[model samples]
Every structure is written in structure tokens, then in C-alpha cells.
Target: MANDKHEEIDPRFKIANREALIGVGLALFNFIWWFAFAYGLGSKPVSEYHYILGMPAWFFYSCVIGSVIMIILVTVIVKFFFKEVPLDDEGEESP
Candidate 1:
């Protein structure tokens, strides 16, 4: 016997998907920023390298500064764009 029941999808899933995409986008942006700084500045000879706060320019910009930037961005995005949705199934009940 084949049971054919089509239950409507929850609307919260859409919001969740959008938030997930934003996370992926942020990750991609982080990767590009890291790659550009790490390779573009790190390609120079050691003798020609620059220092920032006693750290190599490439490392400082790629790892240290990049992390601070990402923290701020994530904080802003979550605080402004993210929603607080209920995790339980109570909202799915029908009258």
C-alpha cells in the first residue's frame, strides 16, 4: 500500500534557508579576503616583508585583522538581520 500524504512545509524553513545562505556568503567572503591578503602580500621575499605590531604584514592582515573584521560583521548581521524563531512545534498545530 502506498501512502500519499502531502504535508505543507513550515514557513520557518524559508527563513532558516535565507539565514543559512547569508552564513555561506560570509564564509566565502572571509575566504576571499584571507586568500587575497595572504598570497598577495606574502609572495614578497622575506627581506622585503613589512611588519605590523611585530607581525608580518601578510599574517597580520590575513589572520589577525581579518578575524576582528569577521567578528564585527557577524555581530552586526546577527543583531540586525537575524530573527528569533520558536524551536518547538506548537506553532504548527491546526485549529
Candidate 2:
């Protein structure tokens, strides 16, 4: 018996899937990183407000560094988990 409800997929589905996942993943990572970097909302505010190597609490960039760290973590995760695809000349699939 034919299961007519089943949908057919193109042979190149994996290529599109990887590209889309990576694109969205990178975009999401960048957005989260940027917000974290700009807001500086995480962690406790410095009570001392003293200069740590000539940097004040409000002026210091622990959040920015954390965002960078987040990006690195995402990058590593994507690299480790995602499959690799080779692009053709002009960065388009060769027919």
C-alpha cells in the first residue's frame, strides 16, 4: 500500500538543510552576542568601582568578553556537530 501522505524530498536536501541551519545558527549567535555585549547586564555590578589595571567597573567589558566567549562556544559547537559541504566555483552549485 502506498502512503500517499508522505512528502517527497529533493536529493539535495542535506545541502540546503546545512546551509540554512548554519545561517540561522550564526545569526542567532550574533544577535545574542551583540545584545549581551551592548547591555552589560549579566554579573554583579562592581561595588568597589576600583580600577582593575586602569579599568573601572562600569567601563570594564566583562560582558563583551563573555559575548565573545559565547560566540566562540557556538562556533565550536557548530564546527563539531555540523556536517561539511564543499561549494563550487562562484560559490554556487555547478550544473
Question: What overall lDDT goes with each candidate model?
Answer: 0.89, 0.56
Runs in model 1 with CA error above 4 Å? 1-9
Please provide, for model 1 over 15-62, each residue's C-alpha lDDT reduced to its tens digit, 9 standing for 90 to 100: 798899999999999999999999999999999999999999999999
For residues 1-95, could you state the per-residue lDDT of candidate 2 as single tens digits?
23232113332456667668877877786666656544553333666455546765333444545467666877886778666545433543434
TM-score list, all predictions: 0.85, 0.41
Number of the predicted model whose lDDT against the real structure is largest:
1
